[model samples]
Target chain A: MALDYALLVLAAPASGHSSLTAVRFARALLARGHSLQRVFFLDNGTLTGLAAAVTPQDEHSPLQQWAQLAEEHQTELILCISSALKRGLLDSTEATRHERPGATVHPAFELGGLGLLVEAAQTADRLVTFG
Target chain B: MTAAARKSILVVSRHAHPGSSLPRSALDTALAAAAFDQPVALLFQGEGVLQLLSEQDSRAAGVRNLRKVLDSLPLYEIETLHVDAAAAAAFGLDRDALPAGAEWLDAAGIRALLARHDHVLGF
Candidate 1:
């Protein structure tokens, strides 16, 4: 039987392979027919939601890959609201609320509270963390 | 959710305080789980035991005092706190040196705690 999976990503793409590993793992599991309940970004992991981040032409962009995964698979990509705000990542709603100059959150992701992470823990068959 | 439907979560914090963000993140996760009524357990291993130090002054580090968060554990109903005995001793911390209400676990006890939870998050 296919298991329901939720991922907690704590490593930033710039610092380590943990975020990339999580993306690949997500793809692999989804390919095997497992249901991805959500991918919650926390701490530095919220950096993945930077739509303005420009990747070098030669490198594989984990950012693009993540966005594509959400576009293709209809996956829920959520950034921890507290972590995201602290890291200066804002969606349009958050930007307006916080009076920020602009929003940096990618369209594929939504800013949510830690309660969503708790909900995932309670509901998902597997809760995985990468940091 | 029914009792059987509620998944138990184990957060294994394995980083040191002051230098890294993982320790705080791990505790936030544990608190969030507890807030949602999920049975949550927190395990401090490796350098993570340093976070339980009662005398840490966050002002010096320019970070929020994690001791404050530790103190709020009871309020969140997250009572199951485990500290690796060897890790604490390695850092020269005695029982009274850290926060109260934390249970000391040996290697085997750590293994059992990992096995008891439905999901384990290592930070």
Candidate 2:
């Protein structure tokens, strides 16, 4: 039977291939008919939502693939609000309040609290993290 | 937070205090799981064992005292704590010098323990 999977991506883009591998794992699970409950980004993983990141040609950018996965499969992409704010990743609403430049987090990702993590932990059959 | 659905979780904390907030955050996560009655085990490896040193004084550095939080783990129903033996030794920490309750685990022991958990979270 197909199981619910929660993929928690915790590595920064510069830190080796963890984030890329996470995206690949997500794709493989989806291909095999597993249900992706959500992809929760924490710490440096939130950088994946930074819209201004430009990947050089000949390189595979999992950040872009994460956005694409959300678009195609409607997967929930959540970044911890506290971690995001601390890292200076501000959405438009937060930008207006903080008076900083608006952040690059794509519209496909939502800034949420750690409570969502608890929910995922409670409901998902499997919780996998890559960092 | 009913007790019936608690998952078996292993939390591997890999950083130090006064530099990274992850150790405290990992504690909070463990506390949350404990509050929900999840069976949780905490393992301190790498620089994470530094949080367990006796003279930490993290508060003077403007960070919350992770050592204090760790002391309260039992109150939160989280009593299983482990320290990586090799990591501790590499950091020049003697097993007897650690806090009163944490057990020691070697690399193989840590791996075997992790294999038994339904979920493993690293910091």
Candidate 3:
């Protein structure tokens, strides 16, 4: 069966294995013909969308990897609005609204409300949260 | 959505406060689901039972007090609060030290609770 899965990312890119594991799981599931409904980032997981994150030359950039995955899979990448704001992961509109210096959110991701996660939980065949 | 139409969501909080913020997020998720008209249940298991201890002050620590959030669960219509009996006992918490209205569950009861839910989000 081609199950539709929604992933909740709760771990930061550099903190633990959850983010990388989620990326790998997404790739694997998509390859198996499963549909990824959305990838919702919460808590420190919102840090994965940092626009200015610099990766070591020897290491793969999780930010770019996530961006590429969303682009290729047409997957919705959402960051929790409160969590993003707390971590300063803002989009252009949010930055302007808050009169911040600049937007730090990447183009691939959008800031969203908790309602989106609630909806995803209701609609997706499976909701997997990685933290 | 009506009661029958909504998905039954179980938010499993398994961590202690002050050490990690995930416990707060788990409660937030439950409240959000309840606000969205989904059937929501919150379970405090493992080290998560530590959150049930009354009067934890985090004002000086500069972090949001999770008890404030937990106290608000009923206002959101999330009355299905659960606590693992073993976890609570392991933490040496008397029943009075915990909040009122929480149903204490044994291991099998917890298993049944998970089985009945449409979705389980663990933290």
- What order do candidates take by TM-score, descending? 1, 3, 2
Top candidate on DockQ is 1
lDDT by residue for model 1 over B7-122, one digit each (tens)? Answer: 88899999988789888888888888887788999999999998888888889768888878997898888875799999998998879766667999999998999999999998
DockQ-derived CAPRI band for the predicted complex in model 1? high
| Candidate 3: tens digits of C-alpha lDDT, residues A33-74 | 999979999888999999999989998788999999999999
Residue B119 accuracy (lDDT) in model 3: 85
TM-score of chain B of each: 0.94, 0.91, 0.93
Worst 10 residues of 3 chain A by lDDT: A13-22
RMSD of each: 1.1, 2.6, 1.4
- Candidate by candidate, in order, the iRMS in Å equals 1.0, 2.1, 1.3
Order of models, best lDDT first: 1, 3, 2
Off by over 4 Å in 3: B1-5
Better of 1 and 2 by DockQ: 1
For candidate 2, write residues A1-131 as lDDT tens digits: 89999987788765789988998899899999999979888877777777777888888876788889999888999987877787777788888888886765778788887777777887888999897
Interface RMSD of 2: 2.1
